[model samples]
Target chain A: MNGISAEQLNQAHQADLAIQSEEGVVFEHAWADPDEGVIYCLSDAPSAEAVMRIHQRAGHPADEIHAVPLEV
Target chain B: MNGISAEQLNQAHQADLAIQSEEGVVFEHAWADPDEGVIYCLSDAPSAEAVMRIHQRAGHPADEIHAVPLEV
Candidate 1:
């Protein structure tokens, strides 16, 4: 969480949306754990690399990427 | 990701759902990175502790818990 404020997350999310279309990524949801300095975002993308690219361009590169092929 | 399979995640998710009602937790989604040995789950719960409790009862205690109060 590293003292990240709601405003910062909102701004980052907005930035992500702005550039996502270029990568065929649709950000669905985001959750922040400010206490843990962690953020979790749900998105639809062509691949895990696409998600990471968007995040990197948005100015916050993800620490890890996981492919979610199945949902229940 | 640790070689965890989709079936394993499905089983854990089902177990969480079975006992979540007692703790006021609703697991919404889950994503697994078997290669990374990590599982990320999204849930609606009274608190981070409540979510952890449900996961624990289901036999998969989360390594970390984050409160997601904002979404985009």
Candidate 2:
């Protein structure tokens, strides 16, 4: 997330996409602002740990993962 | 984005929701980490500026906005 470029972020996304289903996670989408030293991933997974684990395996562990509210 | 609490974030979200339709934005979902001093919004809007202008009007302008990748 920090000191990374858009190209690197997408590279990591591709890596996660390669192994996500085996991890019981769906790589829905990602957003990042390298200027802010952060990347955000939105996914369908049972747990935040599952999401984190996938990213770790992909060599892109998330800085934080929060379940988003689906409705107001 | 900084020095704000979850309650305040929700308050801002509600404000945006009140005027989003007219602003040409659909408030899809939102995520925040008060500890990180950041809030992330996922919406269907014409442009990032549209998103920002709405939030600005709501008094919680976004710090950064990026078009997320839909596919690898």
Candidate 3:
């Protein structure tokens, strides 16, 4: 996937306002493995720390959360 | 993601030789949703019909399996 631009991230953050109100925080893309049962996702939060907080609050704590761009 | 080329699919089928020996057939990319508990994947099977057959045998049959390329 192309790297998300700062402007895009900002827009995503703005768009997530509604989701944040309901789901707490919305991840861009999230998926889990059937066999391994591991979930992975990309979130546009204020910071990597915020991403972890979101996951923690969701009760599905991430096994690994990286502050990196997702490559397709 | 780029569309799987006929040659790439052929190579993948050949490379999956080892997996087919054990797991029956291998999918290219697969993911599931934790909350939704739905799985999605890309498979380069002999035919669309074959793709469904693989999923049926896997037990967690697909809810929607399209014969379209996955866009990253």
Interface RMSD of each: 1.8, 5.1, 13.1
Residue range with the least summed lDDT across 10 consecutive positions in model 2 chain B: B63-72
Clashes of 1: 10
Q: What's the distance in Å from true for residue A12, model 3? A: 20
* Candidate 3 reference-contact recovery: 0.00
* TM-score of each prediction: 0.86, 0.61, 0.34
Predictions' DockQ, in order:
0.60, 0.24, 0.03
**lDDT tens per residue, model 1, B1-72:** 488888988998999999999999999988887776878888999998999999888888999888877666
lDDT for B65 (candidate 2): 80
Candidate 2 lDDT over A25-52, as tens digits, reads 9988877656556677788888889999
DockQ of 1: 0.60
Residues B1-72, candidate 2: write the lDDT tens digits: 545666777787889999998769998877765554657788888887898899899887777787553323
Error of 1 at A66 (Å): 1.7
lDDT score, residue A52, model 3? 66
Query: Candidate 2 — which residues are off by over 4 angstroms?
Result: B1-14, B17-28, B31-39, B43-72
lDDT, candidate 3, at A23 = 41
lDDT tens string, model 3, A23-62? 4455665433323333446565666566666555544456
Clashing pairs in 1: A1-A34, A1-A36, A1-A37, A1-A38, B1-B33, B1-B34, B1-B36, B1-B37, B1-B38, B2-B37
Clashing pairs in 3: A1-A72, B1-B72
Residue ranges of candidate 3 with Cα displaced over 4 Å: A1-26, A69-72, B1-72
